[model samples]
Target: MSQRPRPCRWLRRPGSDLGLRLTLAAAAAVLLLVPFTVLMLLVATAWPPLLALDAHLAATLHAGTSANPALAGVLQLWTDMFAPGPLRVLVGVVAVWLWWRGARRVALWAVVTMVAGGLLGAGLKLLLGRDRPEFLDPVSHATGYSFPSGHSLTAALGAGVLLLIFLPFVPDASPVRTQRATRWTIIAAALIVTVATGLTRVALGVHWLSDVVAGWTLGVAVIAATTAAFATWRGLPARRSPQGGSGRPPPRDMPGRT
Candidate 1:
């Protein structure tokens, strides 16, 4: 008589390293959230020092940008390119591509991260009801509450999502130097984009420094939360595969896996 096939060992016992990564991700989320919460309280209370810093930077940048129309124009263009709406669309396209490539879980995680970040940013904006910097000769104009900069939040989220999704493809193998170079290059590029987005928003005089900082922290925190949740659900470690493939290993239950 034919006997029933046994279940895959993975299903019976999850990867051993998942718990540590999950804990780390959770810790990251809390760490990011703490500073963001503090900032929110300070902004809500109109803390004198924070307000003074915001005024000082906004005035300084405005003075320079307003004098140099060319620089202001360039910053405006950069801000438009990295706006939350465009970034969300780009992330959606990437999610579709990921799904087609059989990284459905990662794709889903990407979608969730973008959607959650967008909603959270908007909610905070409404809750705070903060005003954008007002200038007699404003270098740039944005019509919305501006406690946490939407552009900054979206840019950070976009960079982070792209990094995590593509990291698995970095060949971490025999060529140690090449692998390190590739990984650091990707990391640096992401950092540059994220930081530049915030700086441009501030230089354009549309967002305060604190606004940009809050956006950065919140965006990262959201990513960490989702990553931890996904890792736990999949019973997989939150790490890139040694094989330099997708972000996570295919479970035995997956169609192409054996």
Candidate 2:
């Protein structure tokens, strides 16, 4: 009769398997981000028309700018801070702080993702060399070529990094995904911060809808790649130390055995 290997005395079943499962999920998620990256690549082709998309988005906002005053106010705050100013700096600091607390690897990934997004957006903007809105009343003022909005790029990068920071910790309950309250809360916060901040660009009249989409695409791709790398590294469980220093002795309780 075959016998099952006993669960390691020191090993916690679900938590121990978590790294491997998360790595797989991160890999799968990275595959998903590829299409988004392609779309961002296509931004070069479609960028010229973004002025029109911006106009449409602006018209919609202008038509009924404040359906939910409270919500509008919240969104307004985001719009005000869409630039690479003090607010941006504050956000950057918070993101870095988050990465340092529980997961240094993740925090580093966030920084990489942001830098990647910024560089990608800059290159695309220069290549496209597109013009800004012909007639403008943007909530935020902008100069130079416009297409993939820098504001949107930074926001997406920030959000993507935040999501990556939080994703692994969530109680996935499905073999690998951990679900802890703090993780879920942070995940929700990250999504809110990213989406809200990205939209602020549109409201402020700086970026077209297409620009945000592209930024989101590129940002997600960068983050996915970062997460995939982390996942790959973490997939391997820690080996029991020499002399089994890290290993725990067999459990005192045995099934149907005294």
Candidate 3:
């Protein structure tokens, strides 16, 4: 008889896998649903706190737009680069490259995470039917329902997925200090990209501050869920060989296997 794979240290505790999964599920639910609820409240009643913050940001950022053409130009460039179309193209390229490198599962996860984030953002915008911020003159034009900033959502999603995918490449045998430094560097870079993308959306007056917040929250939830799922899949025991011995499965070229 083949022996079962041993559980990890944490899983060896009282609740085991069920407890870990439930914890992840609860965290994901709160991260995903709370932002959604707040968005609905904003849509249904124009929640005062959110509205006031949006107005203040718009007034502060939109001031002197005409005087700082260069700054406006740079922000607009960042906005355009992180927009849905360009982001999709970038995701596609990364997916193709990963496939070429034989990391098909990682590639698929990245693509799905990004595409799902975009679709979710679009669906929420349509359902809420909230209008873009018009409290001040928009330095850049945007046409769509604006309950959630798509650029912010996709940027966050991309940053998160990329970070997770690359994290495993860090050598486990490295000195603890080196590992810690590398991890922090990766995290900082991801945060910078995600925050910069969201800030540009608000700075341009094309999206409300609440819109960006919801986008960031939702994107993080998606990343968390995907990470949990992938971990579960990886932890599954390898199939037994026909010789009545357990062994790892033979590698195969399976696209979108995740």
RMSD of each: 8.3, 9.4, 6.2
The deviation in Å at residue 230 for candidate 3 is 3.6
What lDDT is obtained when candidate 1 is compared to the true structure?
Answer: 0.83
Error of 2 at 234 (Å): 4.9
Model 2 ranges with Cα > 4 A deviation = 1-34, 37-43, 46-54, 62-76, 82-103, 136-139, 166-185, 233-258
Error of 2 at 203 (Å): 2.4
Candidate 3: stretches off by over 4 Å: 1-22, 64-66, 135-137, 172-175, 233-258
Off by over 4 Å in 1: 1-14, 236-258
* Model 2 lDDT tens row, 1-258: 422222111112235656666666576557756765565565656655644666788667643544445655666677666554543465467555644443344444455556666777788889778665433434446686776677666766665554554454333344433445566677777677667767776665556666677666666666666555655544444558688664644322211112
Writing each residue's lDDT as its tens digit, candidate 3 over 175-237 gives 999999998998898898789989888888788878888888888887767655555554466
Best by lDDT: 1
TM-scores for candidates 1 onward, in order: 0.86, 0.60, 0.78
lDDT by candidate, in order shown:
0.83, 0.57, 0.73
**Count of backbone collisions within predicted model 2:** 9
Please say which candidate is ahead in lDDT: 1 or 2: 1
